[model samples]
Target: MSTLAAMIAADYGTIGDILRERARETPERLAVVMETGEAVTYAQFDALADRVAAALQRDGIQPGEAVAVCALSSIPYAALFLGALRAGVAVAPIAPSSTPGAIAGMVADCGARLFFLDAGVAEAQKPAPVPARQIALDGSAVGEAFDAWLAPEGATPAPVEIGPKHPFNIIYSSGTTGTPKGIVQSHGMRWKHIFVGDTIGYAHAPVSLLSTPLYSNTTLVCFFPTLAGGGTVVLMKKFDVVRYLELAQTHRVTHTMLVPVQYRRLMEHPDFDRYDLSSTRMKFCTSAPFSAELKGEVLRRWRGGLVEYFGMTEGGGTCILMAHEHPDKLHTVGRPAPGHDIRLIDEDGREVGPGVVGEIVGRSASMMNGYHGRADKTAEATWTSPEGLSFIRTGDVGRFDEDGFLTLMDRKKDMIISGGFNIYPSDLEAVLATHPAVVEAAVVGVPSDAWGETPVAFVAARGQADPEAIRAFVNDKVGKTQRLAEVRFVDALPRSHIGKVLKRELRETWQKSPTT
Candidate 1:
C-alpha cells in the first residue's frame, strides 16, 4: 500500500499538513464514504485532491484564492475540501439543493474564484454572474469510476506553509439583523479547539457515526477533532431514522453528535427498539439545549449515557457535558474547554456571578480570526485582553452553576435554532422583502411541538402575498431548516427607526397576537 510520504512533515506553517500527514501514514485507511458505498482511502483521497489542486493550478489558482465547492457531500466534495486547503484556497461548501438566487448571493458574498459543480447545476450556475473557473464534477471529480486526471500529469502542488494565524475557511452565518456575514476561521483557530471526536470520554469510546451536515461547523468541531487523532468517521449521506438505528446496532457505534431534533426523532422513531443502542458509549447533543426530561429519556433509552456540548461557528466551545459528570447535570453544558476562559457577562461585559444568565464570553484558539470583510462586526465580537487571551463574545445567553456547569437559558439573537439548525429571521426577512407586494417582514420562532423552535414569518403587504407562495420561495431558496412552518400577514410591523424592525418587539407582539 502506498502510504503518505513520510518525508513530508508538519513544519506548522501550512493548513494542508493535516490531510497530508494522514495520507502519508495511512494511505489505505478510509477517509470518507458515501451512502452509495463509494469510498476514498487516504492515498486515493490524496491523489484525487492532488488532481483538484492540479486542475486549479492549470488555470493558475493562486494560493489564498477563495474556491467554493458547490457539489453535494460526496467523494468529490471531500477532494475539493482537502485539495483547496492544501492549495491555500479558502473553502466554503454551498448547499447544492439551494435556490440559484441564494447560491448566487453566496458566491457574490464570498468572492469565490472557482466553482466545482455537477452538470445539472453548471448552466444554472453560469448565469449567477460569478467570475469563476467552473468545472463539472461528473466527468472529472474523483470516485470509484475514477478520473485518469487524478494521476499526476504535471507538477504536483509544492507544499506551502500554513500558519496558526492563516485563515483556513470562511463559513457564512445567517445574519438575523442584516445580510449574512462570512465567519473566517483560521487553521490556528481550529487546532486550538480542545474537545472534539478524540477527547477521552471518562472511559475510552470509539466508532462515531456522523449525521451532521459535513459542511456545518459541528462536523468540523465534533468530527474533525476525532479524525485528528485518526478516529474512524462513519458517514450517513442523509439522516434516515431507520438506518440510523440499524447502523448503531450493526457497527456498535459508540459515539455520535446528535441535534436535539434528531434526538427527539430517534427517541420517537418506531424502529429504535428493533436494534441495540446499548453500545452507544457517549452521545453529545448540541445546537440547542436538550430539555431535562428529554435528557432523562435519552439516558434511559441509551442506558444512562447522554451529554451536551455548547459551541458556535464564530467561536470555540463554551462547555461540554463530560461522561464523568452528573445525570442531574445532563441538561447543563459542563465547564469550558481547556484554554478557554468562559464567563457570563451582562450588556456592559461585566462578569456576572454564578446563576446570572447573560451572553457567554469565551476566549480560545478555536475562535474565528475575524468575520470575513465585516471588520466592525469582528471588532464587536472579538476583544483583545491584556492577559494575551483573545476573548470571543458568544451571543447566546447562559450561566454557570456553582458546580461550574453551564445552564442554557435564552438566546439573545432572534436566531431560530430548529432541529439544530440556525435560521436567521432577518435572512428570511431580507428574502421576503424582495417580493413586490411585501411591504415589511418579520420572522420568529413559534413554539413547535415537533421541531423545538420552527420559524414563522409575519408579513405586512401592500397588495397581496400568499403565505404559501412566500413559504415556497424561501423553502426552495434555503437549507431545509430555514423553511418557514407558516406565514401570516400583520397590519403593521413594529420597527425602531433607523427603520430597523425590532425583532424582540415583533416576537412579543406575535406571542400575544390573537392571529398567532
Candidate 2:
C-alpha cells in the first residue's frame, strides 16, 4: 500500500493520543492561543488535558459517561473537551446562548454527572435547578474554579480502551424549545474529519482562527483538524470584524471558518481593505445560506481558497463548493463529496431525476449513530432506500443540475403554498436580494384566507425604500403563484446564533400584526 493509504488506514488511537504525539514531536510549538494574550504550547496543552482526564477519573467519571460544558470559549474548555475524550467520556458542549431552562433541561437529558459553566452562564442559570456538580471555567464563585478541579500536574488517569464505535461527543441541535436532540458522533467520524486535510495540503503548519463558538459544529470542522495536524488555533471569545482582521494579519493565519453573516460583516467593515490577509490559505463557510453574490464578493476580495460546505450536524452527507475552482457553480452547493451517496427523493419517497426538486437524503460513513435517547425521533430522521441502505433525511428542498451540482430551494418546512401550488421562498428571496437597496431578505409563509398560505417578505435595507414598491417589483419578477402577499422592512432579520434566519419568528410577528 502507498504511504497515504497506510496513514489513512492506520489507527490514530484517540484524540488524546494525537495530542500526545504532537506534544512529543513539537513540545515548544504553540497549540492554542486566545485573544486574551494567553498561549499554551503543545506540551502544556497535552499535560493540561492529561490533568483534566485524571481529575475526571478521580471524581469517578466512568467510561462512556457524559460531561457537559455550558461555558464560553476558553483554553480550559478545550482542555476539558480533549480530557473527556481521553477518559473515554463523551463531551456535550451546550450553547451558552441557550436559555436557563433549556440549558438545565439539556443537562438533565444528557444525564451528565459533571457540568461546567462560565461565570456569566452560572449566574444566569442560578435560578434553575441543576443535578450535577458544577465547575466554573472562568475563575468564578460558582461550584468550583477550573484550577481547583484539576488533578495534580503530573498525575495520569487509568487508560481506557477506545474503539471506533465509542462516542466522542454529542452535539445538541439548536432551536429546540424543550430538550434538544443530541446528535451522537462517533470517534471514527471525528477521526475522518481530523485527517480530511491530509490530501488537501493541510500538513503544513497552518494557523486557524476560530471566531464561531466552540459549541457549534460549524467551528469544529476547522478547529479540530488544525490541532490534529499540529497547527495553531486562535480562539476568539466573540467575533469582531476589526479584531479578526488584526489577528489574521498578525498571526499570518492560514485557515479559518466563519458563517455567512460574519463574512457579510467583514466585507462591509469600514476598514475592510485596510488589512493584510495575504497569508490566508483556506477559508470555509457553513451553517447558513450563503448567497452567490456574497461568495463572489469574498472570492474577489479575499486572498485564499473559499470553500462552502452544506450539511447537517447529523453528518449524513457533505457537499463542498470550491468557489475558487468552480466560479461558474457559485450558485450551486457543488457536487456530493467523495464517498457520499446523495439522492433527492420526492414527497412520495421516490427518487427524483436531475433538475427535479426533492428532499435530499444521503448515506455516508460519517453519519451519526442516532439521536441520543430518542429512538422514535431518530427513526423519523432516517430513511431506507429501495436497496435497504440506510440514509439520513435532510429536510432541505433542492435539485441537482446537469453537472450534479445541487441548488437549494429553501427548506421543506419553509416552502410557501398558495392556491395549492408549491412556491419556494428562496426564489422570491433571490428576487428581493437583487434589489439595489436590500441588504438581506427573508420570505416566510403566512396564513391567508383566500390562498390558505401566502408568501410575505421581510427585508433589511440600506436606505428608506418603500416596502410596497419593493413588493411590487419582486412580484413582477416572480410567477403569479409565488408573488408576495406583503412586504415589511426591518433594521435586521432575526437570526440564530449561527446566522440562520428565523423565518418562524417572522411568521409569528406577521400573524400578530393588527393589519394582518
Error of 2 at 274 (Å): 1.4
- Which regions of candidate 2 fall more than 4 Å away from where they truly are? 1-12, 176-179
Per-model root-mean-square deviation over C-alphas: 11.0, 1.7
- lDDT tens digits, residue span 112-189, model 2: 999999888987887886789999888788879899999988888899998888999999998533358999998988
The reply for model 1, stretches above 4 Å from the true place, is: 1-15, 97-99, 119-129, 138-155, 194-197, 201-206, 303-305, 383-390, 414-516
Best by lDDT: 2
Clashes of each: 6, 0
| Candidate 2 least-lDDT 10 residues | 2-11
Q: TM-score for every candidate vs. truth?
A: 0.73, 0.97
How displaced is residue 338 in candidate 2, in Å? 0.6
For candidate 1, which ten residues in a row score worst on lDDT? 2-11
